[model samples]
Target: MHEQREFIPLDKEQTPMDTPKRTIWIQALKVAFPHTIPILAGFTFLGIAYGIFMHSLGFHAMYPFIISMVVFAGSMEFITANLLLGAFNPVYAFFLTIMVNARHLFYGISLLDTYKGIGKKKWYMIFGLCDESFAINQSIDVPKNVDKGLVMFFVTILNQIYWVVGATIGGVFGYLITFNTEGLEFVMTALFVVIFIEQWMKEDRHVSSLVGIAASVVCLLLFGKDTFIIPAMIAILGILTLARKPLEKGRVSVQ
Candidate 1:
Protein backbone atom coordinates (compact mmCIF):
# COMPACT_ATOMS: atom_id res chain seq x y z
CA MET A 1 0.00 0.00 0.00
CA HIS A 2 1.20 3.51 -0.84
CA GLU A 3 1.79 5.85 2.09
CA GLN A 4 -0.89 8.58 2.20
CA ARG A 5 -0.04 12.23 2.72
CA GLU A 6 -2.39 15.10 3.67
CA PHE A 7 -2.80 17.65 0.90
CA ILE A 8 -1.46 21.12 1.72
CA PRO A 9 -2.18 24.41 0.02
CA LEU A 10 1.25 25.86 -0.75
CA ASP A 11 0.15 29.21 -2.26
CA LYS A 12 -0.16 32.04 0.31
CA GLU A 13 -2.71 33.88 -1.89
CA GLN A 14 -5.05 30.86 -1.69
CA THR A 15 -6.05 31.81 1.87
CA PRO A 16 -9.70 32.75 2.16
CA MET A 17 -10.28 36.51 2.30
CA ASP A 18 -13.19 36.24 4.77
CA THR A 19 -11.29 34.15 7.31
CA PRO A 20 -12.82 35.46 10.54
CA LYS A 21 -10.48 37.82 12.36
CA ARG A 22 -13.40 38.57 14.66
CA THR A 23 -13.34 34.97 15.92
CA ILE A 24 -10.94 35.95 18.68
CA TRP A 25 -13.28 38.66 19.94
CA ILE A 26 -16.27 36.34 19.73
CA GLN A 27 -14.47 33.68 21.69
CA ALA A 28 -13.30 36.21 24.24
CA LEU A 29 -16.81 37.59 24.67
CA LYS A 30 -18.23 34.07 25.09
CA VAL A 31 -15.73 33.31 27.80
CA ALA A 32 -15.83 36.66 29.55
CA PHE A 33 -19.59 37.39 29.61
CA PRO A 34 -20.57 34.40 31.70
CA HIS A 35 -18.00 35.37 34.32
CA THR A 36 -19.65 38.77 34.63
CA ILE A 37 -23.26 37.56 34.99
CA PRO A 38 -23.36 38.35 38.70
CA ILE A 39 -21.98 41.78 38.05
CA LEU A 40 -24.61 42.25 35.35
CA ALA A 41 -27.41 41.75 37.83
CA GLY A 42 -25.80 43.93 40.48
CA PHE A 43 -24.74 46.78 38.19
CA THR A 44 -28.09 46.86 36.42
CA PHE A 45 -30.00 47.31 39.66
CA LEU A 46 -27.53 49.82 41.05
CA GLY A 47 -27.46 51.75 37.78
CA ILE A 48 -31.22 51.98 37.73
CA ALA A 49 -31.21 53.23 41.30
CA TYR A 50 -28.58 55.81 40.37
CA GLY A 51 -30.58 56.95 37.36
CA ILE A 52 -33.70 57.23 39.47
CA PHE A 53 -31.73 59.16 42.02
CA MET A 54 -30.46 61.54 39.37
CA HIS A 55 -33.89 61.88 37.85
CA SER A 56 -35.33 62.70 41.24
CA LEU A 57 -32.72 65.43 41.46
CA GLY A 58 -33.96 66.83 38.10
CA PHE A 59 -30.90 65.82 36.07
CA HIS A 60 -31.42 64.44 32.56
CA ALA A 61 -31.15 60.77 31.60
CA MET A 62 -27.87 61.48 29.83
CA TYR A 63 -26.27 62.17 33.18
CA PRO A 64 -26.20 58.56 34.32
CA PHE A 65 -25.20 57.14 30.93
CA ILE A 66 -22.40 59.67 30.56
CA ILE A 67 -21.16 59.17 34.08
CA SER A 68 -21.40 55.41 33.85
CA MET A 69 -19.39 55.42 30.63
CA VAL A 70 -16.82 57.95 31.77
CA VAL A 71 -16.31 57.45 35.50
CA PHE A 72 -17.44 53.79 35.49
CA ALA A 73 -16.77 53.52 39.22
CA GLY A 74 -20.09 52.82 40.93
CA SER A 75 -19.20 54.21 44.36
CA MET A 76 -17.37 57.22 43.00
CA GLU A 77 -20.18 57.94 40.53
CA PHE A 78 -22.62 57.98 43.44
CA ILE A 79 -20.34 60.41 45.23
CA THR A 80 -20.38 62.53 42.08
CA ALA A 81 -24.12 62.87 42.53
CA ASN A 82 -23.52 64.44 45.93
CA LEU A 83 -20.70 66.59 44.59
CA LEU A 84 -23.06 67.94 41.98
CA LEU A 85 -25.44 68.97 44.71
CA GLY A 86 -22.76 70.54 46.88
CA ALA A 87 -20.74 73.72 46.52
CA PHE A 88 -18.04 73.63 43.84
CA ASN A 89 -14.86 72.17 45.30
CA PRO A 90 -12.75 70.61 42.57
CA VAL A 91 -9.84 70.09 44.94
CA TYR A 92 -11.89 68.07 47.41
CA ALA A 93 -13.53 66.07 44.66
CA PHE A 94 -10.14 65.23 43.14
CA PHE A 95 -8.78 64.04 46.47
CA LEU A 96 -11.97 62.14 47.24
CA THR A 97 -11.79 60.31 43.88
CA ILE A 98 -8.15 59.35 44.49
CA MET A 99 -9.00 58.18 48.00
CA VAL A 100 -12.00 56.15 46.83
CA ASN A 101 -9.97 54.43 44.11
CA ALA A 102 -6.71 53.94 45.98
CA ARG A 103 -7.30 50.20 45.75
CA HIS A 104 -6.46 50.36 42.05
CA LEU A 105 -2.86 51.01 42.99
CA PHE A 106 -2.67 47.55 44.49
CA TYR A 107 -4.51 46.08 41.52
CA GLY A 108 -2.01 47.69 39.16
CA ILE A 109 0.89 46.26 41.13
CA SER A 110 -0.62 42.77 41.04
CA LEU A 111 -1.29 42.95 37.30
CA LEU A 112 1.98 44.52 36.24
CA ASP A 113 3.42 41.34 34.77
CA THR A 114 0.11 39.95 33.57
CA TYR A 115 -0.35 43.04 31.42
CA LYS A 116 3.23 43.53 30.35
CA GLY A 117 2.97 42.31 26.75
CA ILE A 118 -0.68 43.06 25.83
CA GLY A 119 0.46 46.11 23.81
CA LYS A 120 -2.09 48.89 23.05
CA LYS A 121 -4.90 47.09 24.83
CA LYS A 122 -3.09 47.81 28.10
CA TRP A 123 -4.32 51.41 28.11
CA TYR A 124 -7.96 50.41 27.85
CA MET A 125 -7.43 47.72 30.44
CA ILE A 126 -6.07 50.27 32.87
CA PHE A 127 -8.85 52.76 32.14
CA GLY A 128 -11.55 50.16 32.71
CA LEU A 129 -10.00 48.42 35.70
CA CYS A 130 -13.04 48.51 37.97
CA ASP A 131 -13.43 46.28 41.01
CA GLU A 132 -15.38 43.59 39.18
CA SER A 133 -13.07 43.54 36.18
CA PHE A 134 -9.99 43.36 38.37
CA ALA A 135 -11.40 40.57 40.53
CA ILE A 136 -12.52 38.40 37.63
CA ASN A 137 -9.52 38.97 35.39
CA GLN A 138 -7.05 38.47 38.19
CA SER A 139 -8.61 35.39 39.79
CA ILE A 140 -9.77 33.30 36.83
CA ASP A 141 -7.39 31.40 34.60
CA VAL A 142 -8.00 32.30 30.99
CA PRO A 143 -8.86 29.23 28.96
CA LYS A 144 -6.44 27.84 26.39
CA ASN A 145 -6.76 29.53 22.95
CA VAL A 146 -8.62 32.51 24.38
CA ASP A 147 -7.02 35.95 24.21
CA LYS A 148 -6.67 37.30 27.71
CA GLY A 149 -6.61 40.90 26.60
CA LEU A 150 -9.80 40.56 24.58
CA VAL A 151 -11.50 38.71 27.41
CA MET A 152 -10.65 41.47 29.86
CA PHE A 153 -11.75 44.14 27.40
CA PHE A 154 -15.11 42.51 26.81
CA VAL A 155 -15.70 42.14 30.51
CA THR A 156 -15.17 45.86 30.92
CA ILE A 157 -17.38 46.74 27.97
CA LEU A 158 -20.26 44.43 28.92
CA ASN A 159 -20.27 45.73 32.49
CA GLN A 160 -20.40 49.34 31.38
CA ILE A 161 -23.20 48.48 28.97
CA TYR A 162 -25.29 46.91 31.74
CA TRP A 163 -24.84 49.93 33.97
CA VAL A 164 -25.62 52.44 31.24
CA VAL A 165 -28.69 50.53 30.08
CA GLY A 166 -30.08 50.26 33.60
CA ALA A 167 -29.40 53.87 34.40
CA THR A 168 -30.95 55.10 31.16
CA ILE A 169 -34.12 53.09 31.67
CA GLY A 170 -34.47 54.29 35.22
CA GLY A 171 -33.94 57.88 34.21
CA VAL A 172 -36.56 57.65 31.47
CA PHE A 173 -39.08 56.17 33.93
CA GLY A 174 -38.04 58.18 36.93
CA TYR A 175 -41.47 59.71 37.44
CA LEU A 176 -43.28 56.47 36.59
CA ILE A 177 -41.65 54.36 39.31
CA THR A 178 -42.29 55.20 42.95
CA PHE A 179 -41.03 52.15 44.78
CA ASN A 180 -38.77 52.78 47.75
CA THR A 181 -35.26 51.43 47.16
CA GLU A 182 -34.03 51.55 50.73
CA GLY A 183 -31.11 49.17 51.42
CA LEU A 184 -30.48 48.75 47.71
CA GLU A 185 -27.24 50.60 48.16
CA PHE A 186 -26.03 47.77 50.37
CA VAL A 187 -25.52 45.59 47.31
CA MET A 188 -22.08 47.11 46.64
CA THR A 189 -21.02 46.68 50.25
CA ALA A 190 -22.12 43.06 50.23
CA LEU A 191 -20.35 42.49 46.93
CA PHE A 192 -17.07 43.87 48.27
CA VAL A 193 -17.35 41.83 51.45
CA VAL A 194 -17.68 38.68 49.36
CA ILE A 195 -14.64 39.69 47.28
CA PHE A 196 -12.64 40.39 50.43
CA ILE A 197 -13.49 36.98 51.88
CA GLU A 198 -12.62 35.19 48.65
CA GLN A 199 -9.28 36.99 48.40
CA TRP A 200 -8.54 36.23 52.03
CA MET A 201 -9.26 32.54 51.53
CA LYS A 202 -6.93 32.34 48.55
CA GLU A 203 -3.98 33.65 50.48
CA ASP A 204 -1.50 31.45 52.45
CA ARG A 205 -1.08 34.10 55.12
CA HIS A 206 -3.63 36.62 56.35
CA VAL A 207 -1.08 39.34 57.02
CA SER A 208 -2.45 41.71 54.37
CA SER A 209 -6.01 41.00 55.43
CA LEU A 210 -5.24 41.69 59.06
CA VAL A 211 -3.40 44.85 58.22
CA GLY A 212 -6.31 46.13 56.12
CA ILE A 213 -8.86 45.50 58.85
CA ALA A 214 -6.72 46.88 61.64
CA ALA A 215 -5.75 49.97 59.68
CA SER A 216 -9.32 50.69 58.65
CA VAL A 217 -10.57 50.28 62.19
CA VAL A 218 -7.88 52.52 63.59
CA CYS A 219 -8.54 55.18 60.98
CA LEU A 220 -12.28 55.01 61.40
CA LEU A 221 -11.86 55.57 65.11
CA LEU A 222 -9.54 58.49 64.60
CA PHE A 223 -11.02 60.18 61.54
CA GLY A 224 -14.60 58.92 61.49
CA LYS A 225 -16.25 57.11 58.55
CA ASP A 226 -16.32 60.02 56.12
CA THR A 227 -12.60 60.69 56.36
CA PHE A 228 -11.21 57.30 57.29
CA ILE A 229 -10.58 55.83 53.85
CA ILE A 230 -7.70 58.14 52.86
CA PRO A 231 -5.87 57.70 56.12
CA ALA A 232 -6.52 53.97 56.12
CA MET A 233 -5.10 53.72 52.62
CA ILE A 234 -2.01 55.63 53.64
CA ALA A 235 -1.51 53.43 56.68
CA ILE A 236 -2.01 50.23 54.70
CA LEU A 237 0.54 51.26 52.06
CA GLY A 238 3.02 52.28 54.73
CA ILE A 239 2.63 49.05 56.66
CA LEU A 240 2.88 46.88 53.58
CA THR A 241 5.97 48.73 52.34
CA LEU A 242 7.69 48.36 55.68
CA ALA A 243 6.85 44.67 55.85
CA ARG A 244 7.84 43.89 52.24
CA LYS A 245 11.30 42.51 53.09
CA PRO A 246 10.04 40.09 55.72
CA LEU A 247 7.11 39.05 53.52
CA GLU A 248 9.42 38.40 50.56
CA LYS A 249 11.83 36.38 52.73
CA GLY A 250 8.96 34.28 54.10
CA ARG A 251 7.58 33.65 50.60
CA VAL A 252 11.06 32.66 49.37
CA SER A 253 11.58 30.28 52.28
CA VAL A 254 8.22 28.63 51.58
CA GLN A 255 9.19 28.07 47.96
Candidate 2:
Protein backbone atom coordinates (compact mmCIF):
# COMPACT_ATOMS: atom_id res chain seq x y z
CA MET A 1 0.00 0.00 0.00
CA HIS A 2 2.85 2.41 0.81
CA GLU A 3 4.66 1.52 -2.42
CA GLN A 4 1.52 2.16 -4.45
CA ARG A 5 1.20 5.72 -3.09
CA GLU A 6 1.96 8.29 -5.78
CA PHE A 7 1.21 11.85 -6.80
CA ILE A 8 -0.12 13.01 -10.16
CA PRO A 9 1.19 16.29 -11.54
CA LEU A 10 -1.28 19.16 -11.36
CA ASP A 11 -1.20 19.51 -15.14
CA LYS A 12 -1.87 15.81 -15.53
CA GLU A 13 -4.96 15.79 -13.34
CA GLN A 14 -7.81 14.26 -15.28
CA THR A 15 -11.03 16.19 -14.80
CA PRO A 16 -14.16 14.72 -16.23
CA MET A 17 -15.79 17.02 -18.72
CA ASP A 18 -19.39 17.93 -18.02
CA THR A 19 -21.91 17.01 -20.66
CA PRO A 20 -24.33 19.85 -21.48
CA LYS A 21 -27.59 19.47 -19.54
CA ARG A 22 -30.11 21.91 -21.02
CA THR A 23 -32.90 21.57 -23.52
CA ILE A 24 -31.18 23.65 -26.19
CA TRP A 25 -34.15 23.45 -28.51
CA ILE A 26 -36.45 25.01 -25.93
CA GLN A 27 -33.83 27.48 -24.83
CA ALA A 28 -33.32 28.43 -28.44
CA LEU A 29 -37.02 29.15 -28.93
CA LYS A 30 -37.42 31.32 -25.82
CA VAL A 31 -34.22 33.30 -26.29
CA ALA A 32 -34.95 33.88 -29.97
CA PHE A 33 -38.48 35.31 -29.66
CA PRO A 34 -37.70 38.76 -28.28
CA HIS A 35 -34.80 39.51 -30.61
CA THR A 36 -36.67 38.00 -33.50
CA ILE A 37 -38.91 41.08 -33.91
CA PRO A 38 -36.25 43.53 -35.05
CA ILE A 39 -34.47 40.82 -36.94
CA LEU A 40 -37.60 39.69 -38.76
CA ALA A 41 -38.67 43.21 -39.72
CA GLY A 42 -35.22 44.26 -40.84
CA PHE A 43 -34.71 41.05 -42.74
CA THR A 44 -38.12 41.36 -44.34
CA PHE A 45 -37.12 44.65 -45.92
CA LEU A 46 -33.71 43.37 -47.05
CA GLY A 47 -35.13 40.12 -48.29
CA ILE A 48 -37.79 41.97 -50.22
CA ALA A 49 -35.09 43.98 -51.96
CA TYR A 50 -33.23 40.84 -52.89
CA GLY A 51 -36.36 39.07 -54.08
CA ILE A 52 -37.40 42.08 -56.12
CA PHE A 53 -34.01 42.09 -57.77
CA MET A 54 -34.25 38.39 -58.55
CA HIS A 55 -37.81 38.54 -59.80
CA SER A 56 -37.04 41.51 -62.06
CA LEU A 57 -34.47 39.31 -63.74
CA GLY A 58 -37.29 37.08 -65.02
CA PHE A 59 -37.14 34.54 -62.24
CA HIS A 60 -40.07 33.68 -60.00
CA ALA A 61 -40.51 34.61 -56.29
CA MET A 62 -39.75 31.03 -55.32
CA TYR A 63 -36.11 31.46 -56.29
CA PRO A 64 -35.25 33.76 -53.39
CA PHE A 65 -37.29 31.66 -50.96
CA ILE A 66 -35.31 28.52 -51.71
CA ILE A 67 -31.93 30.24 -51.70
CA SER A 68 -32.60 32.09 -48.43
CA MET A 69 -33.26 28.86 -46.53
CA VAL A 70 -30.21 27.01 -47.83
CA VAL A 71 -27.69 29.85 -48.03
CA PHE A 72 -29.08 31.54 -44.92
CA ALA A 73 -26.78 34.47 -45.44
CA GLY A 74 -28.07 37.98 -46.09
CA SER A 75 -25.23 39.41 -48.20
CA MET A 76 -24.47 36.15 -49.90
CA GLU A 77 -28.08 35.52 -50.82
CA PHE A 78 -28.39 39.02 -52.26
CA ILE A 79 -25.51 38.59 -54.68
CA THR A 80 -26.38 34.99 -55.53
CA ALA A 81 -29.16 35.99 -57.92
CA ASN A 82 -26.50 36.91 -60.47
CA LEU A 83 -25.29 33.34 -60.31
CA LEU A 84 -28.57 32.11 -61.65
CA LEU A 85 -28.88 34.84 -64.28
CA GLY A 86 -25.61 34.55 -66.13
CA ALA A 87 -22.99 31.82 -66.39
CA PHE A 88 -23.90 29.33 -63.68
CA ASN A 89 -20.56 27.66 -63.31
CA PRO A 90 -20.67 25.58 -60.16
CA VAL A 91 -16.92 25.69 -59.67
CA TYR A 92 -16.60 29.47 -59.89
CA ALA A 93 -19.63 29.97 -57.67
CA PHE A 94 -18.08 27.66 -55.08
CA PHE A 95 -14.78 29.51 -55.11
CA LEU A 96 -16.47 32.92 -55.15
CA THR A 97 -18.43 32.03 -52.06
CA ILE A 98 -15.28 31.10 -50.18
CA MET A 99 -13.58 34.32 -51.23
CA VAL A 100 -16.57 36.52 -50.40
CA ASN A 101 -17.21 35.08 -46.96
CA ALA A 102 -13.62 34.29 -46.04
CA ARG A 103 -13.96 36.69 -43.09
CA HIS A 104 -16.04 33.97 -41.41
CA LEU A 105 -12.88 32.00 -40.74
CA PHE A 106 -11.68 34.77 -38.44
CA TYR A 107 -15.12 35.09 -36.80
CA GLY A 108 -14.93 31.42 -35.80
CA ILE A 109 -11.70 31.99 -33.86
CA SER A 110 -13.43 34.47 -31.49
CA LEU A 111 -15.95 31.76 -30.64
CA LEU A 112 -13.38 29.07 -29.87
CA ASP A 113 -13.45 29.41 -26.08
CA THR A 114 -17.11 30.37 -25.93
CA TYR A 115 -18.29 27.29 -27.79
CA LYS A 116 -15.67 24.84 -26.54
CA GLY A 117 -18.13 23.01 -24.32
CA ILE A 118 -21.45 21.50 -25.41
CA GLY A 119 -20.15 18.43 -27.15
CA LYS A 120 -23.05 17.89 -29.55
CA LYS A 121 -24.29 21.50 -29.79
CA LYS A 122 -20.91 22.77 -30.98
CA TRP A 123 -21.46 21.50 -34.50
CA TYR A 124 -24.88 23.09 -35.04
CA MET A 125 -23.69 26.27 -33.39
CA ILE A 126 -20.86 26.63 -35.87
CA PHE A 127 -23.16 26.07 -38.82
CA GLY A 128 -25.45 28.88 -37.62
CA LEU A 129 -22.59 31.36 -37.33
CA CYS A 130 -23.21 34.65 -39.18
CA ASP A 131 -22.35 38.33 -38.89
CA GLU A 132 -25.36 39.61 -36.89
CA SER A 133 -25.33 36.59 -34.63
CA PHE A 134 -21.61 37.02 -34.08
CA ALA A 135 -22.08 40.70 -33.26
CA ILE A 136 -24.77 39.89 -30.68
CA ASN A 137 -22.90 36.94 -29.15
CA GLN A 138 -19.50 38.58 -28.92
CA SER A 139 -20.95 41.56 -27.06
CA ILE A 140 -21.55 39.45 -23.95
CA ASP A 141 -19.31 37.19 -21.89
CA VAL A 142 -21.36 34.20 -20.98
CA PRO A 143 -21.21 33.01 -17.36
CA LYS A 144 -19.94 29.53 -16.57
CA ASN A 145 -21.98 26.63 -18.00
CA VAL A 146 -24.29 28.90 -20.04
CA ASP A 147 -25.31 27.33 -23.33
CA LYS A 148 -24.29 30.15 -25.64
CA GLY A 149 -24.19 27.82 -28.59
CA LEU A 150 -27.90 27.27 -28.23
CA VAL A 151 -28.56 30.99 -28.05
CA MET A 152 -26.41 31.64 -31.06
CA PHE A 153 -28.11 28.87 -33.01
CA PHE A 154 -31.51 30.32 -32.34
CA VAL A 155 -30.41 33.82 -33.23
CA THR A 156 -29.09 32.58 -36.54
CA ILE A 157 -32.21 30.58 -37.32
CA LEU A 158 -34.41 33.59 -36.53
CA ASN A 159 -32.37 35.90 -38.69
CA GLN A 160 -32.71 33.45 -41.57
CA ILE A 161 -36.44 33.21 -41.15
CA TYR A 162 -36.69 36.98 -41.51
CA TRP A 163 -34.68 36.94 -44.70
CA VAL A 164 -36.66 34.10 -46.21
CA VAL A 165 -40.00 35.68 -45.39
CA GLY A 166 -38.94 39.09 -46.69
CA ALA A 167 -37.49 37.69 -49.85
CA THR A 168 -40.61 35.67 -50.56
CA ILE A 169 -42.81 38.76 -50.08
CA GLY A 170 -40.66 40.88 -52.36
CA GLY A 171 -40.38 38.31 -55.12
CA VAL A 172 -44.10 37.63 -55.19
CA PHE A 173 -45.32 41.21 -54.89
CA GLY A 174 -42.52 42.96 -56.78
CA TYR A 175 -44.16 42.89 -60.19
CA LEU A 176 -47.66 43.66 -59.13
CA ILE A 177 -46.67 46.75 -57.11
CA THR A 178 -43.95 48.91 -58.67
CA PHE A 179 -42.59 51.45 -56.21
CA ASN A 180 -39.27 52.97 -55.19
CA THR A 181 -37.32 50.27 -53.41
CA GLU A 182 -34.26 52.49 -53.70
CA GLY A 183 -32.55 53.62 -50.47
CA LEU A 184 -34.48 51.01 -48.52
CA GLU A 185 -31.36 48.88 -48.66
CA PHE A 186 -29.76 51.43 -46.39
CA VAL A 187 -31.93 50.01 -43.64
CA MET A 188 -29.36 47.28 -43.10
CA THR A 189 -26.70 49.89 -42.45
CA ALA A 190 -29.11 51.64 -40.11
CA LEU A 191 -29.46 48.46 -38.09
CA PHE A 192 -25.72 48.40 -37.58
CA VAL A 193 -25.77 52.01 -36.44
CA VAL A 194 -28.51 51.25 -33.94
CA ILE A 195 -26.52 48.38 -32.49
CA PHE A 196 -23.40 50.51 -32.30
CA ILE A 197 -25.29 53.23 -30.45
CA GLU A 198 -26.72 50.69 -28.02
CA GLN A 199 -23.29 49.27 -27.35
CA TRP A 200 -21.83 52.73 -26.92
CA MET A 201 -24.52 53.62 -24.39
CA LYS A 202 -23.66 50.59 -22.28
CA GLU A 203 -19.90 50.99 -22.57
CA ASP A 204 -17.53 53.96 -22.52
CA ARG A 205 -15.45 53.45 -25.58
CA HIS A 206 -16.70 55.20 -28.68
CA VAL A 207 -13.11 55.29 -29.90
CA SER A 208 -13.37 52.17 -32.00
CA SER A 209 -16.19 53.53 -34.10
CA LEU A 210 -14.45 56.85 -34.38
CA VAL A 211 -11.27 55.24 -35.62
CA GLY A 212 -13.21 53.04 -38.01
CA ILE A 213 -15.14 55.97 -39.48
CA ALA A 214 -12.02 58.07 -39.87
CA ALA A 215 -10.07 55.29 -41.49
CA SER A 216 -12.98 54.30 -43.70
CA VAL A 217 -13.41 57.88 -44.92
CA VAL A 218 -9.75 58.11 -45.87
CA CYS A 219 -9.74 54.69 -47.45
CA LEU A 220 -12.90 55.45 -49.35
CA LEU A 221 -11.27 58.54 -50.85
CA LEU A 222 -8.00 56.79 -51.70
CA PHE A 223 -9.22 53.36 -52.77
CA GLY A 224 -12.64 54.16 -54.19
CA LYS A 225 -15.83 52.44 -53.06
CA ASP A 226 -15.16 49.04 -54.62
CA THR A 227 -11.74 48.55 -52.97
CA PHE A 228 -12.35 50.60 -49.80
CA ILE A 229 -14.05 48.06 -47.51
CA ILE A 230 -11.15 45.63 -47.21
CA PRO A 231 -8.59 48.40 -46.80
CA ALA A 232 -10.77 50.12 -44.19
CA MET A 233 -10.99 46.88 -42.26
CA ILE A 234 -7.21 46.50 -42.36
CA ALA A 235 -6.74 50.10 -41.26
CA ILE A 236 -9.17 49.69 -38.35
CA LEU A 237 -7.40 46.50 -37.26
CA GLY A 238 -4.03 48.19 -37.46
CA ILE A 239 -5.23 51.17 -35.47
CA LEU A 240 -6.59 48.88 -32.73
CA THR A 241 -3.34 46.95 -32.57
CA LEU A 242 -1.26 50.11 -32.39
CA ALA A 243 -3.51 51.56 -29.72
CA ARG A 244 -3.30 48.50 -27.45
CA LYS A 245 -0.40 49.87 -25.44
CA PRO A 246 -2.03 53.27 -24.95
CA LEU A 247 -5.22 51.52 -23.90
CA GLU A 248 -3.36 49.23 -21.47
CA LYS A 249 -0.99 51.93 -20.14
CA GLY A 250 -3.88 54.22 -19.19
CA ARG A 251 -3.01 56.83 -21.79
CA VAL A 252 -6.49 56.57 -23.26
CA SER A 253 -9.80 57.25 -21.60
CA VAL A 254 -12.55 54.74 -22.27
CA GLN A 255 -15.21 56.65 -20.40
Cα RMSD to native, each candidate?
8.5, 7.9
Clashes (candidate 1)? 0
Q: Per-residue lDDT for 105-209 in model 1, tens only?
A: 988998876665565767888888888788777776688666676687788778778888988887888567667766765766676777778878878888988
Q: What local lDDT score does residue 3 receive in model 2, on the 0 to 100 scale?
A: 39
- Tens digits of per-residue lDDT, candidate 2, 25-57, equal 465556656655666667777788788888889
Best by TM-score: 1
Best by lDDT: 1
Clashing pairs in 2: none
